[model samples]
Target: MIRALLDPSEGEPVQIERAGGRSPVILVCEHASRTIPASLSNLGVKPDTLTSHAAWDIGALATAQKISQLLDAPLVHQRFSRLVYDCNRPPEAPDAIPEMSEIHAIPGNRNLSGEARQQRVAEIYEPFRQALAALVAARTGPSRQPVIVTIHSYTRVYFGAARHRAIGLLHDRDRRLADTMLQQAEEHGITNAMRNYPYGPDDGVTHTLRLHAVQNGLLNVMIEYCSDLIDTEKGQDEWAALTTRLLEAALERFDIHAAGSQQA
Candidate 1:
């Protein structure tokens, strides 16, 4: 029933959303939403679980929206349960089709045979990859060098564990973006911002950054918002503004301007 109800053609991919013309930049949110269709009642999830971190990034969707709006850049977001399949994950990872993400058991995804697994890869996963390829392909111009920016969020605590830290900016050796953003966040008085923790590009092994950024050797940066921070409307606005300022400032120093611009 769940499979039958899926509307892949409407651009309701295991991922979704794309906009703006060519730019030197691309924004991707891998854990944007947790919306399964009307069928299977969340593929057999309990009520509480459907709205939890296992499903979505908690605040990433709204944050991504704000960033896309502010930057006037295209954003591609994953639209289904990360449990059904994590678009950020490489095809071969064991947890690529996670039966359980953290504490939530995705009964619908458990123990599938090779054919079933491959079908999911074909039907849902492949379309997204192809669309991404198309996005990259479409981004050709005389002055543009495509830079991929991936948006994501993390739980404030690990397994309900506690941390005094408020936020983190996760990157790996991408000094151009990371240094600038880190400095901007600090100068902006975002006192609790950590340089990198919980996870970094090294930690998110099969992440979208690896798929597109590292593979293509483009400028890539991934930001992780702590869920508790952007879990509210006011919170979203504040962080979005913060992100925009820091990123724009950073890009300028790096001489990375959006393509299709007057400058470009």
Candidate 2:
């Protein structure tokens, strides 16, 4: 028998907070945890690499949770490391189980068999995908329309090159929410915001947005916070407040009700 990716004691792969939240906004943090399944033995990575951006999006979960609290929105996050499955990516994507993330090479992923890859997909990605899908579906009727907002954080420097942007509002073909957020950032005194600076759809970074939001014709946007900016509780709270304001502004711009119903 193939060694299982997740043990019986490992708990569920997807974590949903405020599942019954009244807000129509559904927040997602795909790279929330740096936890590798004990079966994977840390994927043979170094101690520091195990906690680095390659393993998870630093500060993203805390920021997302804060946004969820501020908006009374529901949050769905993955419990396993992105190096294990990359919940944002589809099963066929090349980097879904990356062999290398930036300068750190993933030793266990180097020679993964078909079964190993499939195991990660079945054990890690599927649960996260299904939970998020179910949440969206539940909010997708005439009475309520859900918004998809995925949160993430990026490193100050990657491969020795520094990233200057403090925040990023990314979107795919549908730029409705992202555009409005960017426009409102300056008004909120957040002048360092940029459009698709750190990563874009071309980089396959918008998988969650494309799959859950664009395909469903729902309003959506991906928010990227610089790691250094949201690395503390104060920073998380500050960014969360900013995100809540921007989301409210965008919803109002679209005439979406706070109760999640369309004005019509």
Could you tell me how far off, in angstroms, the CA of residue 3 lies in candidate 1 after the best superposition? 6.7
Considering only N, C-alpha and C atoms within 3 Å, which residue pairs clash in candidate 1?
24-259
In the range 22-47, model 1's lDDT, one tens digit per residue, is 44667887778777755435777777
Best model per lDDT: 2
| Runs in model 1 lying further than 4 Å from the true structure | 1-11, 14-18, 21-23, 38-41, 172-175, 258-264
Best by TM-score: 2
Clash pairs for candidate 2? none
Residues forming the 10-long window of minimal summed lDDT in candidate 1: 1-10
The sequence of per-residue lDDT tens digits that candidate 2 reaches over residues 1-264 is: 598778889999999998988788899999999999998889899998987899999999999998888777889999989998899899999999999999888999998888888998999999999999999998889867899999999999998999999999999999999998898888876889999879999999999999899999999999999999999999999888887877887788988744322222
CA shift at 162, candidate 1, in angstroms?
1.7
